[model samples]
Target chain A: MSRKLNFYAGPSVLPVEVLEELQANIVDYQGNGFSLIEASHRGKVYDKVHNEAIALIKELMGISDDYSVIFLGGGATLQFSMVPMNFLVDGKVGDYTLTGTWAKKAYTDAEKIGKVHAVFDGKDKNYTTLPEASSVKPSANSAYLHLTSNETIGGLEWKHWPETGDVPLIADMSSDILSRPVPVDKFAMIYAGAQKNLGPAGATIAIIRNDLLERCGDHLTAYLNYKTHTKSNALYNTPPVFSIWGIKLVLEWIKKTGGAEAMAKRAEKKSALLYGTMAESNGFYRCPVDEKYRSTMNVVFRLPNEELEAKFLKESEEAGMLGLKGHRSVGGCRASIYNSLPEDAVSTLAQFMKEFQRKNG
Target chain B: MSRKLNFYAGPSVLPVEVLEELQANIVDYQGNGFSLIEASHRGKVYDKVHNEAIALIKELMGISDDYSVIFLGGGATLQFSMVPMNFLVDGKVGDYTLTGTWAKKAYTDAEKIGKVHAVFDGKDKNYTTLPEASSVKPSANSAYLHLTSNETIGGLEWKHWPETGDVPLIADMSSDILSRPVPVDKFAMIYAGAQKNLGPAGATIAIIRNDLLERCGDHLTAYLNYKTHTKSNALYNTPPVFSIWGIKLVLEWIKKTGGAEAMAKRAEKKSALLYGTMAESNGFYRCPVDEKYRSTMNVVFRLPNEELEAKFLKESEEAGMLGLKGHRSVGGCRASIYNSLPEDAVSTLAQFMKEFQRKNG
Candidate 1:
């Protein structure tokens, strides 16, 4: 069967190969008499899948033994709470860069736990750009610096990261993780919800440096405390067995298809093709985010009016394209082409965009 | 291909029909040209699935309009903390009945958030029996009474619920949800990890009465806040979409196969056959749990010696019967016969038991 062009922001597309693999193993995993979902997380079958998933992340990202790769549930929203619950103590300030919707929400979530400082705010520019790296700085004696590496809502991403020096750096890399090469050692911790650039929802991956485990407080509940997860290897209580297995397969696919470096090259090509078309649209179609900080994963653009935007979405859906509607918080159009999205699909979308402009411009 | 008789305690068996249905749609859900896991949670497809799952739970359990069914991630361990975070506030005593390992863990988790009272402790009896209904009582000013409906560890189940009077009652029904008929209105709230009788191991079902939403605290993080989840219909964040879809299928299966009433009858028969065989052994096999309170879900038993117990597990696995090994906390034989366990499998287990005893007697 022919697949639809999936651009829906997340619970988004997965590699066709990954989906096929999951299909093959859905009933019985490797001739095991039971389904993978029926297998115990503590059992031998899942232990291998769990370990391989962790190993693949380490290998693909060039991560050293300094980090522990963990699979968790509750998506990036839970991580928004956990990062502060673990690192931000009563006496320490947690520095945050408010780049877009997710970063702002993360900053808000942290406020419920302890003191947090928004060191930089991009909302002043309607979340169209990132903070200048030179002006960004963690507060004196701050517990950690937090930022969203990519914001799906406004189609914004940080082209350059801030230098936190001695302070630990944390990022909500939910949209951008595994889409390109990342320097694992530069940041103290990183987390991503698995729906984008990975496998599916249900699982969130956390890559935390070993030293950060010390900052986990006593008042936190067992599941809320990162130390409990780290110590138990993310199996403290049945760590989303099926989703972790799905992640393992997606990670293996990532490794086999030439690691993060290869993904970076692919992203550069895919984004350039789509962005070039938008750039040449002669203001018929306009991108909202700044050119330097535009997200390669989610491309946001707008037509002349809401009526035309509505027409664009209707025409695109009829042509077998899906999830092109922009985030409700910031409406217009968003074509989120994640790692699993083929380059040809984006080219098709660009061609469609030009045609739509000719008819509606 | 023949399926294995899965008897593992939590992350346990699902219906073979459910597995086949999942396999059929693993790649293209209803020929939509995309995997269900790849569908957007906010999209219409997932919205239908999300609503159907909640509706099925309410219908099957005979739940009234007063209760709301919410799906959350991070297993029942998260609920252990969330129960207290929402309801166990300061100046109010949260009463707990320590029936088994999980109940003890729930009590420990609640202590991290607020004042809790252990109304009854079963550890004195090695967690082999539930407190008598007459002997158990909640505090006069208790906020809510919490208990484990079924304990997977020692195979103890509450034969009669404690009288909490006007105070709210909460239960962690992780291992035995949908295995029997439950009076939903009798409890203020119920939460179950979805690895057992439900579907898979990522999503958890939270059935909270409308009034329970008021107990959610303001200081709690967004994901931890019950009110936040209830207000948004559990879509405050991108939910564990695939797991929730799987749950919808399982609940559909339960409804089609004569609902929870039929499941209760099946449990009764399966548990009787296993326990009766143990009873007829005449000291050859000894069940650890008290006769009256022995769980219909998990049947924990011991042989004359550890040597025979090892032999039992080895031979059982070789004979295509798996997960007979009891929990490590209590070293004995355990056969968990959940709702999906076929009657023939239990008969096969019984046959194995009789033959093993005859050879070793």
Candidate 2:
């Protein structure tokens, strides 16, 4: 199979090994006589897969028993609402940091739910910068301090996490989850849409400190309550079975390939290659985001002009590369080199960037 | 490959053809260089898939422009809350019929959301029977009348839909959707989890009459509001990409096999085979569900005693059968013959039932 270099932002590339394994077992999972997709979620076949996925995430991320790692449906966008619905209760205000697009969305959704405060609004800087982790503070009555670890659209990532003493620190890590060694003890909760660094699109992974689940009030509907998922081990409903199975396989791939530390190193190396190439270009390419807040996952940059950007995208597609066009909101180019995207693909792109500049610059 | 006859309930059997197609394209979709799962949800590759899935559902269900067919995540359990959160506004009460475990769960969730009333409760009959569709009536101020089209646990199904003239009629057809044709105009909304007749888990298909969107309030969170999905055509968030693609394949298979009418005939034939076997067994086997309400999708029967039931389950597995054990709530044998389950599998199960009785008796 002639597989192109995929650079899509959120539903980005996955390890070839994971895809091969999924392709091999899509029909009959380990000779259990039926595809895992068609097997009952409560049955032993899928139950094992479900638990293994949770276990691997815990082991890979070094999470403790004090936290519950639950998988839910509806991407990180759902978490934008559920995070506030479950926590912004009992007269507690939600403290949010508007670092970029996704964090702003979480804040906006929370405003519709209850009282919320934005501790740091990056909108003044057009979301091209971030607040100092040590400088940001939550309000006294804040239930939780929320932030997005990385903005896929704005191509900004937090280099360090904020310290929120008593108020729980919650993060939407959809774009950069599993791409680094995170200090799990520092945060009360972390959520991610699996399409980015985990596996596929159907599942959302949430790691909630056990204490936070107690705050999930009875007023919330069953599915909306985090307690329901934690109580049933995310089996309160028929889970995204096929998606979870795919996740289990991807997690296994992660473990076999030297775990989270290896992934972090790969991320640094891949992002540096693209950035280094841009640094060499003489005013031909420019990255809009502040260099300190530059994302390791999604590297957004611009060519000399809109015409060159259009030509670059078309040529990239013809040259066996895809998903190079930036989001419409940000009119430029983006290469999302998530955990599964090989460094070689970035090198290929970097080489292409130089060649394109030579011809046009 | 030693594939066995599978009889799982939800997340149950799927057509071999669908499985093969998925297996073939799990890595490189249509030679697009990357798997569809890896492609961006907003891009052309997945957009075509997303829209085609919606279009096919509209065509197969004979739905018109008046209805907005949308796919969402979090299953029917999420819908339980969303239905009330969106519709049970402005002092309108939701009328629910308590039929079985699933129906009761829906009712209980709505209770937390707003004022609700049980229009026709089958609890008096221990959920072994259903209310006659014509006999059931909604309260005057009812915003909508809700019913479970088929109960996967109790093995009961509504033979005819309730006629609620002014009040919107809604049905959760998670277990038996697409198994037969229905009058599309009768219900204001119909939602089903894709695990059963539609495809795999992760995607929930909702066909809502356009007017229902008007009732979705601004008070609700973005993901919680049905209007958000309708306005963006279910692309409000990064959708469950792989699951929707599978649903599209399953829909195509359904169309090729002969639409819903053909499926109805097959359901009757397959269900009759199992029921006929029980009838021939005389005092050896019993079906607890009322004959009129017996589910064609899930054929549940009890052996003469618990010991025989255990023996039947063990021997069924040894004879290359799987998922024959009933749900834990009710201890018996249940063979879920969903649309994708071949007639040959049912014929074999019937043959096994007869031979088991001959040997055990």
Candidate 3:
């Protein structure tokens, strides 16, 4: 059977080099006559894997002493609840900016545990435009100001994070993290699930500022507590060993292949190619999100009608252009071009889109 | 360099066959000409992988229509809190039996949510024995009775699970699930972290009785809610994709080699051989747990003194036997012979144990 191109929004692309290393060790790792999957997470080999995962994250992101990175279980969803459960206390409201579905989920979870305040809602405009960061009214004494850096559902990106100052600026960077250069100094915490750009979806990465670490309220479960993870270096019980190991490999890939800067450049080039093709289709293809808020990763666009959209998806699938269907909420097609997506795949997708539009018109 | 024999407890071992399949997918998966790691979670390929995972779990365990299986994030530790949050309501008490570290953690979480009646504590016997089922007295109109089927830390295994009759019997089978034949009909819910014997640490399998579907208590976060996962078939959120994929491969390996019955028989053989070897060493090697409660998966033992134990561990490491060190509380060595551990590894370890004893003696 021939290899197939995968275009999943997440649990998406990975570097070939990393996968090859994994493949070689999958059956028997380290010449131990046993597969790496069968290897011990606590042994010397995995200790190196675990330690290097943290180190690599730091090295690539240029994380400093003020920031500590921990590999946690649960997808980005768990952090939606955990971030507030720990940090939101002292009766101060938790400020939220609703840019997309994921950020709203994060806000709703905070509502259950703390006083929540929404700065703006992109929903009013049907999420076609990002909430203006300058217009956000962050509370003076709020526990934290939260935002979704990239709204995967809406194809909205925060070109600049709102300035929350001492009031911890928290981000759910699940989709856009590591896609570009993120200034660690700007936020108290940045968390991302290892699906898009990073690796497979087995673990999450939380980079937290040292000061915010001490503010977790009393009711935090030890497993969900960042302090506990930091204390044990994220080995607070049996961790997701293989997932972390994969992440370690990925961070290494990111570092070896010219860091986040190189990835940001590649993402720009690939997504630009696809979006530019859509723009060239005129009225046949119209992107929903405002140009200023357009995501460099997820290029979501719509056709003349639902039938045409369906036809495009079907034809794309036939041609092996996968995961082009938009999220159900958005009702269009989204081409998520994360970091590991090769430039050639985007070119192929763009060519298909152009041909389809010409014939349909 | 030759690969060292690994024997860590959880995130321990995987069948060699699964690893080979994983390796083949590294560069190009199913002739897709792309790495499996880069494949989309929602694509045709991974969709099949997801269904295959669910089918394998259900088929192997002989699960029926009355139960629904869910693959969740956060490992067992998150479930420790989530179970109580979603199931244990206000004014209701949940029954708990404290067998080891895991059960104790569950009990601790339950305390945060509702009144908990701890029926039995293995701490009295230093966690090496099970508290008899007859000794348990449930709270009136209890939510459910929770027990740890196998305690990894204390090397404790229950020969028979206590019958809860009409009440739900929730078991944390994290360590020894699927190692032997289990009556799927006996429990209302069973949760296991897939590290010890399953495949990897990132994925957790939960089997819930159908009747418990409508009983989600109020106040729990929607993402933390069990009903949400059941309705979406564990794809409510971005699941641990690779872990699920690997688990599917592991399940296939199990089925192709022989089903759970065969796995049980193999477990029995390895345990018996290791026990036999330990016995032949006279007073030099002694397992802490009583004979009747001995685990077929993890075997914990000790030397006469701490110095001798240290010497044994060093010699074992030199002989390529890694992760023989036990828990900090136990202060000895533990050999966790999970499903993927070949009997030959046990034999090799046994040979080393005798050699070390001979040299010291």
Candidate 4:
């Protein structure tokens, strides 16, 4: 069966090569007589898979020795609570920028845990805009400045990172991680759920600076604490084995296909196709995001009316495209073209969008 | 290559049928044009998989509407903290049974959260024996009584449950879930990591009685809160999609092969074969676990000496048996015959055990 152009916002697209490799090894991993899923995490078989996944992430992003790379479960949403629970101690506040849906969620969850101040809230602008990276300032007693590098739902992304000297900077890069070369040294930590650019939906990858590990409080529970993971190298408990295994394959695919630099170029080319189509369409396809903050990962757009959008979705799926429907909260369209989404899928979608607009118009 | 007898503790053996289905669907799920791993959790494809997994658990376990079975990540280790955080309120003590390593870990984590009482401490017995169910009692002000239904490392299991009339009973059944019929109404909650009898390592299944969820505080962060999962049907955040998907398939297999009743008979037959082999070995093979409380899932034993035990593991691996070596914490041998482990594997191991003792004795 031919594969569909998967544009759904995460558990999004993965390279066909990775999926095929996963199929090949699903039952017998390297003729070990058992699937890696069944192997003990402590055993040599899984140890290689686990370490290679971490090493690949570090190599791809150029992470330094000062940083520790770890894989976890519970997705990036758990990180929302864990970040503040570990870092946002008494007498220090967590500074957050509510640029879009994901940023607001991180801020909301942080507020429940401890003292959190929103440095910039885009709610008033209907989450279509982002605060200029240099314009936002953290509080005096800020423990960490938190931001969502890309918002999947709102289609706004941080093209430039915030400058917080002496204050730790943390970003939930769940949607856009490894899509491009990241300045790993600039942030204290960056975490992404593996469903998007990494692998499948079970594992979450976090890169933490060694200094930030000291901030993890003793009061935190074992799994909730970052220190526990760092100590055990994320083998604190039985990891999401299959998920991490998938990530390793996907990472290998990325590395073989020219690493993060090539991913960035592909992301640019893919997003440009859609955005460029909108530009040439004479206002038929409208992107709600600010031009500068438009996400290269999730390109969310809308038609002239709700009826046309519904028609577009119906026609797209009939044309063998899936997940073009926008988030239910904000109705329109979304094409999440992550790292593993082929350039051809984007080209096909671009062609589909043009044909849909022509027939509907 | 023929499959070996897999016995590595958690992340242990899964049904060959389930693995085959996983391999077949790894690239394109049921000709859906995209792998389920790459499908959105909120989409119909994954929503069906998630709901079916929950429904199957409810059906197999005879769970009533009074309970909510939700899937979460971070394994059962996270549940160790979550149980006390949600249920162990102020002015109430969480009653615990330190039956083995897992129980102790749960108790230790709970201690950091709130006041906890060890109703039955098995440390004096070196975690080889379990307290009689009727003999154990919860404190008057106890909010809930927690027990480890099966200890994977120590090869100890609870044959009967502690009766706490008014207080809720919670059990970490990570290693022994679905191996036999369980009285769902007796316990307020039961959670298991899905690497053992269920499926794989990424997902943790929690069966919580409805009343317990109400104890979840509003101050708790979204992912940490039980109410957040129950309200959204475990869709509050992105779930471990592939793990849960694997679980649904396993559950279906369990159902088709005559449900919990058949699993119980198979487990009894398999475990008896190993224990009988030890009993007939005349001190050559010794099981430290008290016979009355011997675990059906993890059958751990020791040979005459450390040298023989090492030789046994080496020969077993060479003879196409894997994971026969015990956990690093305990230097012996363990054959984890989980629900998916074939009866023939146990028979072969029993024959090998007799031959090894005859030669070495």
TM-scores vs. true structure, each candidate:
0.99, 0.99, 0.95, 0.99
- For candidate 4, the per-residue lDDT at B214 reads 79
Error of 4 at B81 (Å): 0.6
lDDT of 2 by residue, A187-215 (tens): 99999999989998899999999998888
Lowest summed lDDT over 10 consecutive residues: which window, candidate 4 chain A? A212-221
1 or 4, greater by DockQ: 4
Estimate, for each residue in B75-173, the C-alpha lDDT of model 2 and write its tens digit. 989999999999988888999999999998999999998999998788778889998889999998999999999999899999998789989999999
Clashes of 3: 11
Q: Each model's DockQ? A: 0.83, 0.86, 0.61, 0.89
Candidate number with the higher lDDT (3 or 4): 4
Decide which is better by lDDT, 2 or 4: 4
- Residue A260 C-alpha lDDT in model 3: 90
**Best candidate, lDDT:** 4
2 or 3, greater by DockQ: 2
In the range B1-361, model 4's lDDT, one tens digit per residue, is 7998887887989999999999999999998999999998888888999999999999999999999999999999999989999999977999999988899899989999999899989888788999999999999999999999999999998899878998999999999999999998999999999999999899999999998877899999989999999999999888999999999999999999999999999999999999999999898999999999999999999988999999999998988888888888888999999999999999999999998888888
Q: Compute the lDDT for candidate 1.
A: 0.88
CAPRI-style docking class of model 2 based on DockQ: high
Among the numbered candidates, top DockQ falls to 4
lDDT tens digits by residue: candidate 3, B1-361: 4555667787786766676677777678777766555666656676788888998999999999899999988888888888887778757789999888889999987887778888787777877788776666566878889999888878889878787778788999998888887998989999999888888778899999988877885466767889888988888787887778788888888888788899899989988887887899888889988898899988888898999999889888888887788977777999888888877888898888878888885
User: What is the fraction of true interface contacts found in candidate 4?
Assistant: 0.89
